[model samples]
Target: MLEARDTVEHEIWWEIKGGTSNVWYENWTKLGALNYVVPTDYPINEELVDVSDLIEGGAWNDQLLHQSFPADIAEHIKSEIYIDQLQGNWDRPWWMLTSTGRYTVNSAWNMLRHRDHEDSDFKQLCIKGVPFKIYFLLWRVLKGRIPTDDVLMKMKIPIASKCYCCSIPQQETIQHLFLTGQFATDVWQVFKNAVGIHMNLTQMKQVRYPCLKNAPFLWNELIDFLEGYKPILVSKIVYWNLPYDGWYKCNSDGASRGNPGPSSYGFCVRNCHGDLVYTECKELGINTSMVAKAMALKKGLMYCFENDLQPLIMETDSLIMKNVVEGIWECPWSIVAEVDIIKKLKARCNVLILHVYREGNSLAYFLTNLAFYFAGTSRFNSFVDLPSAGKRIINMDKQQIPNIRIRNAKNTSGMDIFT
Candidate 1:
């Protein structure tokens, strides 16, 4: 008998019997003989042993008796046998091995195993941050697959014992997020109002919990609630003028450098949210301050009407122009025709003309200066260079009454249309 170390440093004893001396010597030289034992094919029925049991049972069958086994020898043997069997090409789903590697039943594997088809839902889940386990849970929640506490615990989300938002001692699940949080309650209320649906808070919570899974309609309702609630919250903020949450306010102005000499006009329009809707300047040929005022009013009015807005409050730095517009003073004859037409248009809406200080109207003056710079090199008489703001106002007037014309220097040059 001969004894020596095998691959894992485990001792193997070889019994030499009935073999030629030369064969025994060759086996010994190759280290194939262990403890002077020569290799021999022992006839054993391998067919009777269940492969699964063989892998699982491990050292339960005492085939080798050279050494004593450890406390977990049986388990270690079973694990090794199972891995060997897996490598031996047993017919099973590829996912069983793949999932065993990652310890996760990824989506691709799950879809292969189950055949209920939903391409849209499947595509959505393929996005990052969606775990296979979580997606399965959501699908079950949508399909009424209420998981047991053990299954949920297996998911390994942090804070498994309580709701993350409210710290309630329960499974931190989707239902808790939607129904229990204070923010969620406010959101639900706004959502109900937006979709023209009325539901008590408690009723909404109850209905959503039980029906969310297994009901497509309920899933759609949840989607709609999420999508529509934000804009309604914004609208409420604007209507109430809440700080940092309301609509903006904008102010516009127009300026003319010299009455009837190298004139330019500027105007601005803004919303209650304080956003600049439009701002522009135009060079008008040899026009007075009154003409600039008329031009600015035209631009501002056009902007409001085109945007389908009303109840506008327009401010100008020209006190005389503001007074004339509001019927507090008479306008000059040179521009009264245009002013009268604008006043008539203004009366069609809730328009208020107020005189702002020149300091408050600086943006319009800046724009007017820009217009002068550009217009200095252009032809003065043609209306093609008129700002789009002015064009919008002119279009609005034409829409209101066909063929409305204001006589300028070409017809009744000195007549005041307001008279």
Candidate 2:
């Protein structure tokens, strides 16, 4: 009985007369009714079954209801037996503009109005710390304002509207460029590999609707990843500061020659006043970046446990490690073993994982890189002093000297991003 241009939110009901409305196709009851006809092997007299055929004297024909439909759906029909009580068995229309079973023109008009609110993801893109250029580009991308080939052609541009990134003749639409282009797909794969997120990059191109729909989430994660590594302006070298009151700070880093080649992990523990409590470095055989980072975190936690350092705050330049440790994301199978140990260590001690810029973590970075000079693992006890380079970096951090400047790149793929 419902007939409106936009009737998705509207509700329909029927007053029983001669049972003319088809029980299956017709919107004869509230949403809780059997809205769609469930096919079964039972025979029916016609394509449409009216309400009367399923009703008996003052009640539902239980045998017929059971024979004609599944149990759950039959029970739903049985619950609406009050429909048989219409005065004099006369049929009429019942409209439901409001969920409270009241119909009003004003309510109907309001329901038909377009929504006036931005998606939560859009609000995230507009957060204060985000660069204006990056924010604007993401906003445009979400609104389909980017200059894809189809949009360019519509604007009368002379260039052919074909995919250039993939070197394919396929028309370059927004979906094709971001979600299907071969080059774009390959870049995404590299990014996923480098970051160690537990998702298949190929699925971005394989699954059309879901991949494009979650683009905002993917962008948000990328921005977060970049935030951990964004370089700050190097003015004067500063010394590393200690953790806040009642917490010990541990800075950790991982170094690899060829990513999957020989690698090492290092961590330095400092008191609240930037005094070095201890430091340790381990030489790990061939392993991926993900494994190395995970090991570094695990090593730092172990150092704290061995030294009885409680309520520790661990800092690392690897966003992937921090995210995985904090349960923000998943780790790949290769690094799951390390992550599991890290989790157990974290649970044992009052541990907090923080992601910092590499510039701020120079001492840990140095120690990790320094492992390259030594053939075996190295450990410095409380009585020992840090080597010259490590001491120099620590001094710089304590001085609050800027070691690097963070800057946004002109464009990443088709969008501006911080580099």
Candidate 3:
């Protein structure tokens, strides 16, 4: 088992959070043990024992870090190895081998069995109903481990490399033999026409594995797929409706760069005239998009209450959140406490939470995305203070310009329409 020390180190990673992880003892830095990376002269602050000591109010304390460590190390901690600083949980060991961060026999076996590892491209090859042979073939293709002409030539075999698939006598490289050759081009052309995808596929490095899995290998299956998904415009019911007089509407949205990763939320209070009253966008450290959404709504409610902006209608794009609030769906156990807080806030005011489509809630979405551009939470009280694009969206909404949501023609629900 000692032979697997390198493998074990490669597989397990410390997910940094507010609590549990010791600053010096744990492998949270990914550079190996934290003690080794520390400067010899720099004194480790006694107060900085836990990871939480490094964090402050959902962000890394930039000032404290620069004072505590060498400038480069402090920068790395606040930038590269940084979490959002409010993970709401203790630091834990995450299995790098699995998506769920949990260890499993199959994952362990795969790590041990595979001599050559590819850049996660082989993951798409393990499709449901796909054969193991296809999976193996694609895995080799991605890893460049297959005995192609170029690969075989590298093995010191005295042989000339030539492409038999194409009329041009190009060198039989992996890209030429499998992708750019005439026969391969013909095969792809057939699917390109069938799928109606208006994109170039020649970029070798930019291949998305999901597209490869979805593209039909069998011609007969391709025919059925095209037949099922013909081109047609489907009407989707989505638009911002004016709130009743003496009432204000709050629109909130939350999103993440990756689910349960770097996240943020935005919310706004708007009057019946479609004018923005107050808006705020903020980062939420590391959390799921669901948590971010819940936090957005919660913060929006809190803001309204604090400002005495009452009789509010809350609009969110998250359907699950709407259902959870209305008791129509099970609240995610992670966010049950948050949901309860929202419930109490709802009781405090005339709040009606409703689900809105992305098109209808474009302004909130735009606001939510603003967190990515700025360092911290940003606030807007006047329309002029908003970004130009945001102001345009507001103007469009006030002028009753419709936002369309695309749906399947087979399942059209007539509401908003444009030819």
Name the best candidate (by lDDT). Answer: 3
Per-residue lDDT of model 1, residues 1-419, tens digit only: 12311221221111112222232222211233222332244333334223233223323344431122232443333321113112333322111123121224354345445656667965676678888898876677655456544346677734345554553455545565557665566788898888756664434644555323322346667567545632111111101111122332223444556655777776665455434456666777666666677777666665666575556767677777777777777655444434655676676765666665554454455566668778432222223444565444434332332222233332223444323
lDDT values of the candidates?
Answer: 0.47, 0.69, 0.77
User: What is the C-alpha lDDT profile of model 2 across 1-419, one tens digit per residue?
Assistant: 16653364335565455566667655555432344445555455464367776767856788988877778667766652334232444344455554333467776666667556778999888988889999998888889999888888888888766776776668989888877789878888888778665374434423533323223346567455445643223233333456789779999999788977989888889877677788888777786667777778877887788788988889998988888777888655445545766886777788878878787788788888888778877877652467877777666666666675344443233342323
Q: Which stretches of candidate 2 lie over 4 Å from their true place?
A: 1-241, 382-384, 406-408, 411-419
TM-score of 3: 0.50
RMSD to truth, every model: 38.0, 24.8, 10.4
Model 1 regions more than 4 Å off: 1-252, 376-419
lDDT of 3 by residue, 103-137 (tens): 78787877888757555655667889998898888
> Where does model 3 exceed 4 Å of error?
1-230, 410-419
Q: Candidate 2 at residue 335, lDDT?
A: 57
Candidate rank order under lDDT:
3, 2, 1
RMSD in Å for model 1: 38.0
**Which has the higher TM-score value, candidate number 2 or candidate number 3?**
3
